[model samples]
Target: MLQTDDLTRYCDDHRQEALEELEAWLRIPSISADGAYRADVRRAAEHAAARMLALGMQRADVLESKGHPVIYGEWLGAPGKPTALVYGHYDVQPVDPLDLWASPPFEPQVRDGHLFARGAVDDKGQVVMHWEAFAAHLRTRKSLPLNLKYVIEGEEEIGSPNFDDFVARHRDLLACDVVIISDTPVFSEDVPSLTIAVRGLVNWEVHVDGPMLGDQHSGLFGGAIDNPINALAHIVAKLKDEHGRITVPGFYDDVRELEPAERAEIAALPFDETAEAKRLGVPQLHGERGYTPLERMWWRPTLDCNGIWGGYQGEGSKTIIPA
Candidate 1:
């Protein structure tokens, strides 16, 4: 059986070939948000299953889902050891504003020692890393230290509409002692870290209905009518104050304050706010008041309107009170 050193040597020797395989997988335009790329999403799932089988997984197959398919793979030879369910996604977010891309979003490119692709970092790249590690163990050692089961889905980019149902139906099939996920970020390129906890999300959609049946002429009903768009803007503005404190009542009541040790741990991490701000091309940092950027990002609960639309949007002026 091969040792860790042997596996490391094998990986180092085949690094270029691994990169080529990753690039090939990255070429699939599996944008789950758009129905146009539904087939492409399935193709990505099939590719993942094929790769799992090639990596010597005892079982590798694509499972049906209400939305996009899920690829399940397992190697359960290590009896009595803890089973780890590896979770990852193959689907990617839609690439919009195509002109902004340095290269085609589907075409993976290496620039400045960074791989550039839509799902490269968010999930698919990390998924492939797990594959490589597992391959090393199976190919050289001929067995794993512990059982591993992978559940790579293709609808994560679309808010995982069918994921809950899928999980509910596959409870026994996915039973595991712990879950291993690589869908989060490290502190920085220099610091390889694991995320302990992640902030939960709650989404809401508020609608503003005007008296008019649809958009009305501004000349006829400008000041008299209450525009839904204007009302929405007012409501969104009231969510947070100028100081960046959320003004919504009871919004922070359940927000658990960070322990002193947790705060210290976060502070000890290498961070340069100035450099981060510069990298993001922002004039300065802004977020929930009285919290560090990292704290707000990793722990705080914040609200922002993702989308709001009900008005004329054209080159020429079409003044109207949108309904």
Candidate 2:
């Protein structure tokens, strides 16, 4: 077993080198969404695979998916001990509205203790943290206590379009006891925490088409047919009630009810309803009848109308039945 003191000493000595490596990685523009950056995305994947090889992993290979590539690395010497599979993405969000950035997104900088970059947090930085930590343990203790595997993908920013097929095709290669995701922030700097649950996503775009042809004057056909915008508004309003509970039937069937202890723990968190209301410009707070605001945010499922549009959105009003 490796001593804690040895681990600490190794990290302290190699910390600066680790930071430099992270900065170099941050320089790569691995934007998976845009086809132009596909080569850069592959380079990022190759860089991760190279690190795995350098860290003495038994197998380090870059697997090509239909879209952006995936890198898998493993050190499976410890037969009896449990194996850990780590997952992270090397791809970053597309940087648009370029003028808004105080510094270039790809050129990482450290100012007042925080690293500034596009992929620094979600999640090249997180991936590098895992890599450097493994390097330190190897550099100091010469071995990890258990078998470990890493799977860094380059398509997460685009919703991992080919990940399901990739995993199915290589199921045997990725078999492990537990999987860890390193894509989210720590709960707080002081009170370190692990996330046990997160809501699943279902994405879709709603387009409410009304008239068969183009725009007609509202005065001409106001009462002749149903207003698509009004219909959409009605549908959206019925999605939740005054108490904020989702109106969709059977939505709560799979929802795991939090125990009393869990509720108490959530309630103890620092909160001021009035202050939050003021900050949000909300007159008052509202949510599912029984749970506190914290529980609603953390555990409860929610529905939001992210985007909606139907007719003219210009300087002034143009009263027309737009399709």
Whose TM-score is greatest here? 1
Give the Cα error of residue 199 in candidate 1, in Å.
1.7
Q: State candidate 2's TM-score.
A: 0.85
Cα lDDT of all candidates, in order? 0.89, 0.87
Residue pairs with backbone atoms closer than 3 Å in model 2 (clashes): none
Poorest 10 consecutive residues by lDDT, candidate 1: 1-10
> Each model's TM-score, in the order given?
0.94, 0.85
In candidate 1, which residue pairs get closer than 3 Å at backbone N, Cα or C atoms, i.e. clash? none
In angstroms, how far off is 229's CA in candidate 2? 3.8
Kindly list the per-residue Cα lDDT of model 2 for residues 152-221, writing each as its tens digit.
9988877888999999999998999999998865655677678877666666787788888878889999
Off by over 4 Å in 1: 1-3
| lDDT (tens digit, per residue) of candidate 1 on 197-272 | 8766667788888765777888998898788888889999998999888998999898899998999999999999
